[model samples]
Target chain A: MAALNYIRSNEKKLKVIKSNSITFDNDTKPMAQHQLQPENWVDLYADYLFNYAIGRISDSEVAKDLVQETFMAGLKSAKNYKGDAAERTWLIAILKRKVIDYYRKINSNKGKAEVRMNYSAQSDAEGDWLEEQVADPFSSFENSNIENEELGLAIQDCISKLPKKQALVFTMKTIQGISTEDICNELDINPSNLWVMIHRARTALMDCLNQNWF
Target chain B: MISCEKAAIICNKAQYREATFIEKLKLRFHLLMCKTCSKATKKNTQLTSLCDKANLHSLTENDKLKMKEILQEKD
Candidate 1:
């Protein structure tokens, strides 16, 4: 792009861009490239890895197990560490694989039988969602002055009620803000199935909130 | 111009930043003329924020310590 080329050609602008792009924990200070310290790995990255795993899988115990497994794998494979990415980034990559493996194992054991919802039931002959069904009384609920704690719990309750596939897609896409391509690849779902799953998840949440909160 | 049903699908795609540029333009035009769809779109955005605010937590400190011991044992 012209803007990229312009920034590249301008020495001062390039320096500013490079400095701003250095995303370290401290302000503008690049991460220290230290050797992999296995002892400090838990203190340094346990919370981050835990949160990442918990977000993907709803079970806290399972998340803990996955993070522990990631650390173990990290320790065993420490010799292969190239120090290319940030330590946190490398740890996160390992945790992600552990999560994928968890899902793969669970699905295989369950025979990949997913709870499928009839999408057509939500719509009419004209393809519009049935008006009676899509009652969004609290359209302004997000921006309203409602207590976030209560709202958050209510939302979590709603999510916990959804089917496994819908919940996974919804959590990954809407909550985690992961890319569709990555979510699809991770879940072994196609683009259309991803959209359908998202649609069902949202509809379920909407209905759940309407019934309970609104 | 897209139908309300198509617009609704596109709106979800837009929420995920999966909508193409042309799809985005079409959705914008549809939203201007369609109140119901606009409401649905707004609710969709709110759903995301609410979940984010609820902010599901990770393992507790004790759990982390237990897991750390497990990792150490595996090492």
Candidate 2:
């Protein structure tokens, strides 16, 4: 615990393991450590971010892009990596916003098909959950409790079906164990609105699981 | 409406084992008077437990590699 008390000109002071071999870091710059080792950020937080991206973008490629984008953006602004929160939470907060940005961009693409995904019916997010033609894969859950196996599949499927934004909210709050406030900051939603979206997502997913998984 | 929402709330909380005495009371009272709500509540509880026990994540190897590359890539 005995070390040199280094006072960062950034005004935050913490312990430093001082040595005679210390070379003066010429840069009066901030966030040098994180910027120099961006890979370490992902090495530490990639699984968390990747799961989140899958829930939101639903495409491995796009999710990859978003995670990369989140990391790149954070690196460029490492000055903002203030130690006020856990670095994982802070990095994830960045990724959540990235997900919302993707959702908003896609929600406006006029030429895209109006789609309802059935996670149980197909692996792709746009596999079409039309009322006709497709033979609803999860219809078997209606008025019946699940026997086994099917129940588990149904839950996974319902989570997959959740829309990008709502799913992000629900996943961060429930799946990844991020705080709702962090979710709100990342998603740019108010507390009540976030709750409603989360509730609706949960309700819909629960209904889907009830009808399909159980 | 009250019966369904009340039961849903109680049932939802009960799923997390966070239902208050009054929540239990509402669910019980509603169940005593309405068979449909009672059935729905029972199913909700059962289904919620099933969900809590289910493994929602099933990431593939590609998923992990993509994640690793994302994390390790220089910002």
Candidate 3:
């Protein structure tokens, strides 16, 4: 009878182990599932999305509007978010569309004529000739614009690769130009600590950008 | 003479225009003798200009608050 009871308890222990493993699996499942947090969106993603839009559009007012619209569109379509991408990635995708739509709208409106005129004004030697009015393939302005955009994106990419606190400190000081005291107060760090973070961030950023930018 | 590490700190502060006049003088003196620190300073300055050229801008606190309000109202 004692041997029989021992076997019964071992079986019970096996069942308990199996159940524990199942619970562990469930605990980890939600971590893999991304959830939208709209309340934190502004604080977390506004700057990032703004930088992205401004890099492409070069207008603060329009970039701000695009970021706002992207948030609205994100909220409206939050139900359809499949959690396949991170929250920032998803918001950026929406912002990209808003930027394209803005350009399309301008292209289809009276602004198109102004743009064409501006292009023609640059190549005055051609003097109103229809074929010559087209944008010069080798225009320095166009080339620089493309280069600047690529450089901007590359800088943003490097910033994103920094550790979270470093990225926050670097962006606030370098990009946003927030005062050191304000940054210290906002982040609840001492002045020296803030400086340390800034130093480390600058070092890491330079190293990262040197690989691609310099 | 400040150590290379301290010079690096001052160099970073100068990049943000926060280094004091004395600190700036010290950093400059240090850079004059130290090749590595001077190279780092040059790259650091270049990085600052690149950032400026990028024209990266973020929403102001008021703008962020407005965004939050808009999101809350829509939600």
Candidate 4:
């Protein structure tokens, strides 16, 4: 009889508790949708965004400008923000667009010379692999050794040595692991061009690594 | 019936995970018979993994702070 009385008394309290979450949701809609603070974003994502841009742009000054542009765009679109992605991802997406735009403008003006590979050097006139090009069967290049700081620096140096367009494609595709379709769309290059650039980059890096590490 | 040079290209495409299934099978078949191309493929894959392992290119703290101030001024 005592237990039943206690249960009866708490029924109204349980109902109130059940409705509290609904009341809280109704009150916090605007706050939930509010844009992330700009200052905090600098603390959180500036380095990341800058690095991402610099890797592709290959110039710190230009990279910084691009990041700044991303922030400005973000601020402009803050009111229309939808909370689908994390703020960092959203910022990076904006930065990607800016980088793509920057390249598109550069490409339009200069029509930068394509980095042509001397296929004849690596293969026969008929395009068969030359014995010299395949001189060594394999030289053990271990990438699993994460503690290999020297190897890392060597790779960075090699990447820096690549032609600007090749470096951009290499960083975006190989290092950043961005999709090939996105890379082609962003750089305004076809898939065949992207593949050629990537191939040249890999060959260059391999030769560099072989000379430096192995 | 892909030549070694073509096999090498396909091997590279495979390293980027961009090779078609048929191309991948072709490359695999080529590698099974050609020791030189197989070794080349291994090195190519290693290069990609090394790049992944060495992935810490970021802006300096000072620059980040400067960016923050710059962005703040626009607000």
Give all candidate RMSDs, comma-separated.
20.9, 21.3, 15.9, 24.3
Q: State the lDDT of candidate 2 residue by residue for A1-214, as single tens digits.
A: 1122112211221112232113125223444332334655544455456656665565877887787787778777777665544566577788889988888787787657367665566565454456445666555453132223334444545765778677666656655556657777877888668656755776787688655532
Using lDDT as the measure, what is the rank order of every candidate, best first? 3, 4, 1, 2
lDDT of 3 by residue, A1-214 (tens): 5466457557656866996787566657776667899988887777778888987888899999999999999999999998866798899999989999998888886756463335544555655577764777655676566557667776877877788788888888988888999999998999889888988888888888877665
> Which pairs clash (backbone N, Cα, C closer than 3 Å) in model 2?
A42-B71, A141-A211, A146-A214
What lDDT does the true structure give each of the candidates? 0.73, 0.60, 0.83, 0.73
**On a 0 to 100 scale, what is the lDDT of residue A190 in model 2?**
84
Candidate 3 deviant stretches above 4 angstroms: A1-40, A56-58, A82-89, A103-139, A161-166, A178-190, A211-214, B72-75
Q: What's the lDDT for candidate 4? A: 0.73
Task: Write down the lDDT that model 2 would get.
Answer: 0.60
| Chain A TM-score of each candidate structure, as shown | 0.45, 0.36, 0.57, 0.42
Give lDDT tens digits, candidate 4, residues A69-185.
Answer: 899899989877776455876888999999999988887744473556775664546644577467553433432332344445567657667786887678667666789899888
Q: Write the per-residue lDDT of candidate 2 for residues B11-38, one digit (tens) a residue.
A: 6556556567877887887788888877
Which has the higher DockQ value, candidate number 3 or candidate number 4?
Answer: 3
Instruction: Encode model 1's per-residue lDDT on A1-214: one tens digit a residue.
Output: 5455345347545655775566443433435554688877775566557667766787988988888888888889998987656677798899889989988888875546576676566344564457745848646563342345445555665766788578767766766677888888887989888887788889889999876555
Q: Which pairs clash in model 1?
A: none
- Among these predictions, the greatest TM-score belongs to 3
Select the stronger candidate by lDDT from 1 and 4. Answer: 4
TM-score of 2: 0.37
Report the Cα interface RMSD of each model, rounded to 1 decimal.
6.7, 7.0, 2.0, 6.7
